[model samples]
Target: MENNSPRQRQRRRRPKADVAPAPRRAAPVTGRLRPLSQEDMARISEASFDILHDIGLSDASPEAVRAVVGRGGQETEDGRLLFPRSLVEEALAGLRRDFTLCARDPSQDIEMTRSRVHTGSGGASPMVVDLETGAYLPAMLADLYDAARLVDTLDNVQFFSRSMIAGDMETLRDLDINTAYAALAGTSKHVMTSCSQAEHVRDIAGMCFLLAGSAEAFRARPFLSLNINHAVPPLRFDPEACNVLLAGAELGLPVMVNTFGQMGASSPVTIAGCLAQTNAETLAGMVLAWIVNPEVTAIYGARPMVTDLRSGGMAGGSGEQAILTAAATQMAQFYNLPNSTIAGATDSKIADAQAGYEKALSVTMAVQAGANLVTQAAGTQAGLMATSFEAYVIDNDMLGAILGAASPIPVDAQTLAVDVIAQTVRGEGHFLGHPDTYARMKSDFVYPAHADRQAPDAWLANGAPTINSAARQAAQETLANHFPSHIPAEIDRDIRSRFDIKLPRERMRQA
Candidate 1:
């Protein structure tokens, strides 16, 4: 047993030439597409200001009215709150331009600054595509947790923004709290969720405190943010959502004043008209957030969606939707504010050819235009009506390639490889086994984990597999094996003791 055979000796000395390491995580890529000229942006800004001043908005909560009117906002005879241009300008000037979206793991922190783009999962889809059955089903708390685990393992999905609504949760409070819990338990990445009531904001913050060890600790690096839909399109504010926005701002939680206006339905049919209205609504939300807490981190989330005029249905994956979102990013750039937009919400029910092309087209446009945060960029389907675990796996490969395309290219001496080219020409006649090839292969190329790239013979020998089938297998494997334990057991117990935690521990771990 002690004698080493020839085979064992040869195995020990085998070269590791073919093994390639994983590509580095994508850094924030600079946006280079400009859909709107300076003159176009100026006209849109003026139109937005006029809308805010002339039309104003209705149904502002009493607290919001007081906060805004106290700061020189006027109220029309019709009870609509009007924001003065000067006041809006003042709030914009005072907004916090750059802040870090801290994660449970410090290395995952996202810098919220200029045209540096980031993409992640987001939506409130009520249904999920069953991974095994291939049937559409109601999304439960368990489905949300599993999706979070999938997102946790995804290299390109940078954050989790509560992709699915837990239809099993009966009460709104339970829904709000458990949604946040599932996201927190499922990933160490920065999490974002919505609160049903202002009081529920405090409850969620307390749970975050336990996870971070103390209230001070959580506040120092608050990992959770609220996506507050404070504006209801066509010039109005949702009073309840505004209250939640105020509560979140009071707690110093980073908030996105998200506004969605569907063209030809909730908003004007023309693209410019829709943009102007949504832009005004977004600015109004910012004013309210600034009034409550001047230091609060508020993101300009102006999502102007498109509607299929023929059917009056949401065309979230249409070319019009793509350009509209990119133009919104340009508007945010004009104001020098951190912004977010929706992309890749394919109308296709499954991850088919339609879904693939739709997602790639919209995501490419959004990222190229430089959206600070591109939500709904992964795993969304059926026009944001459904979520798919397998879609997350397939979309991860697509996101990596899109982000890689957006990455800056260097044109320096080292990258030029003049010397390496000359030496290869003189000696090997090719660069296949060259040292520079070995050094740059991993750094320069982004290999797909789910997409296939095999020759015809190899494919036939390996049992020709579709991308969907491969992604399904990958999703099932990851969900069965990966379970994040960033929050300790004792802390989880405390969290359950205080809140109505519904996701069973056994479901979270392998048996």
Candidate 2:
């Protein structure tokens, strides 16, 4: 008997004329908010070259000094590494301009070329915002895994960076290894983490190689990347971080050359001056990556925080920070380099009104200005010192609105709906039941799950939950049941046996 139900018959007879375009992992933002004009970018680039040639970065590593000098850079008697303009230009031309960051699951790979505007969490905050108890406490390894799990389910958050440092780990070695393990266990999306020593980088790679089935397979499609802070403020190389950078480069891993120059403190107070110094610092890192292996994929990382001159403290939530992030994005474009910057951080301790405004301002600017990757874009508070689980859901809704604001609206024959308007005017005086309206209902709009949109009386009937409370409920539901099965059990056991993974297997299991 070949009997078909009504639902089955409807599904079989569905029209093929309504085929929608394939959605991208992250849509490329076309809006351009270049605070610095083309002339200004040129002037900034020239000034950066001057700083590199004249003021030169301080180098402590013998290998780095040799690599630079061998490549036409000069070393002063005081040990400052001087880069000639030609050398900087040559490195810029030779650097890997574009690449894809692969993930454990092949479907989650991210294209790192152009201004694609992928937002993710960052900052490696040391504290966690306990929404249940409403207390800020030292973040633990469990929190890190939970954060990754939450990110895996978020649509707007494209990738997961180790958002919080595992402060509960007794040693730095344990912290680094466990952080890597937790992030991997939590999601199959592209994961990025940092290592305290160069050896940790190799150890993490070995773990990843095992997960990928072989060394060659891992190298062919390396699923993990490193975010190494290759230099300290005021132009000095961090020796240990430099080693990590070189290790990742030699292994052909994607290395983000993060440079942090605080305005009015580590760098000049003016926005232009800060960009110039940070740009020079970024160039030095590129040269180092070139010295390691010219084929290494480079991500031009900028985290130039603004300082409050009145109190001599960080003002990460200020408008100046957002402006600096957008301006630096323009500089990365000027060099034709892939870029990432910090946004969405707030000085507010909780995810309240203050946090809302602070995150909205910076995140919007970064998206509109066309940053390739914007870190600290979710689950951050207290000036990048803490992460809140509830904030993840709330920020996801906010990021949806921001993406909507940045995404272009199509104005085609079907979209314009002139015929639909005429039909409505001639007949029912409404087009809600029209075929065109029905076809566009779900695809043409972003419906937020945590944000409230009910009528006043209906809202009161449902207990009138605040955004934070609604977000908390949503986050609780996700954490309670969303356990991903990307990594096989046998592979997980092998990894645990091979490395000192601190996160318990039971913790990853859903209720």
Candidate 3:
């Protein structure tokens, strides 16, 4: 006989109608609804498996190999590590088939591939020198804010850099806090800034905490994440960074392991040779992530550049970079993973004629190539050096233009704005004031103020600043005008307390 206490008796009385309704899933965006072809899947799977099995690892830190030691990983005399063939099969078998990286703000979320091309500027090469002051500095909190603010205000800019904006961070060691703060200040969507310190993964992990309020927050709405490179040799994982990747894996934050492919240097000069190298390096990292946590989400990417054999300078904005970018993205897809790589970058500064040509070529190719994630969007000049606010403005306009070029013709009844176009053609209709025009123009047409369709004399009267000057002023105004979305006072205080930093008086809330 069961004893029914009063509490148990009361629990049985609850009615089904009083329960909360299940949440509804909104319709997936059109691009998200598209499916991959069998050939598409084959190219991705075959190339990805080849990378996992036959390719050689480069500069895989000492500890990385050791992580697989007893499990059939072998070590060389000089400390290079090698994994047996079985590891490749095991790694690929467990990868999650398909899943959305849910957005923190559900309204902002989109599929891995989307109609709108998301892009941003980045400067994570780990060295910055301020020419104005002739000072060498380390990454700091201010730089993170500058990066975040840069991302916040621009409708076209979609990501932030991971370097100090105004300082020389050549010698800075405490990057964990600096990286963490940048992501926190940036928009509450996709952001990549995890600590390089293993134990301090918690510090970066805390930002992910606020983004969704739980580790489970990552399973659906991943926000803050990390990127780790398999150092040029398959030797070992840097203890600090490895720990962070492990933590991110444990927590389910996404990571993109990008290898810097230096053709004729670290990689073979042949495109095929270089792809094999970069792909192997990326796959090794992906396997490591799975080893750390089965639930970890990872992407494959490379910023591989050809080295001019004589000059040794990286030809990042060169034509070959696009081929490499496209090919590698294909390989990542073979593994059924998302990718991130550089685009819209140039070695030229000042938005000159050369700048326009190089940026357009590089960015356009990557877009048409169908890379999932692309950045190096703005202000990447002199090989991603010497910050120019104007350069960012120019890049913003260019990205908007590039995205416009990528738009497929809308075939739906709404876009057929055929009736509206006809009315305007007959000279009896004012399209500008039309409701249909108002509804569609902003979303479909990206008009540029730089476009001077005026008479030569009228253009001269307007002072005719070059794209450079217009961009410069735009960058300055952007920096001045942007502000973080207002966080609640309690949340702001908690964020500040975590860092032990005080807010400036102007930004502080009234007592």
Question: TM-scores of all models?
Answer: 0.95, 0.93, 0.78
Per residue, candidate 2 scores C-alpha lDDT tens digits across 1-511 of: 0113232233224332222323433455543787989999999999999999998888647777887899898999998999999889988999887678888877778777777778888878989887567689788888888899889888788789889988878888898888989899899888989898888888888888888898789878877888888888888888788788888888777888999999999999999999999999988988888877988888999778899999888898899999998999899989888888889989999999999999999999999988888888999999889999999989988988888778777899988888889989999998888888788766666777678999999999999989998787667666666678888999989988888887777667743
Model 1 poorest ten-residue lDDT run? 1-10
| Candidate 3: tens digits of C-alpha lDDT, residues 157-248 | 55554533423233223455545554456454456664555656666666557645666665667765576664453223344555556666
lDDT of each: 0.89, 0.84, 0.58
Model 1: CA > 4 A from native: 1-23
Model 3: lowest-lDDT 10 consecutive positions: 25-34
What is the Å distance of residue 67 in model 2 from its true position?
1.4
Clashing pairs in 2: none
Ranking by lDDT: 1, 2, 3
Distance (Å) between predicted and true CA of 2, model 2? 58
Q: What global local distance difference test value does model 2 have? A: 0.84
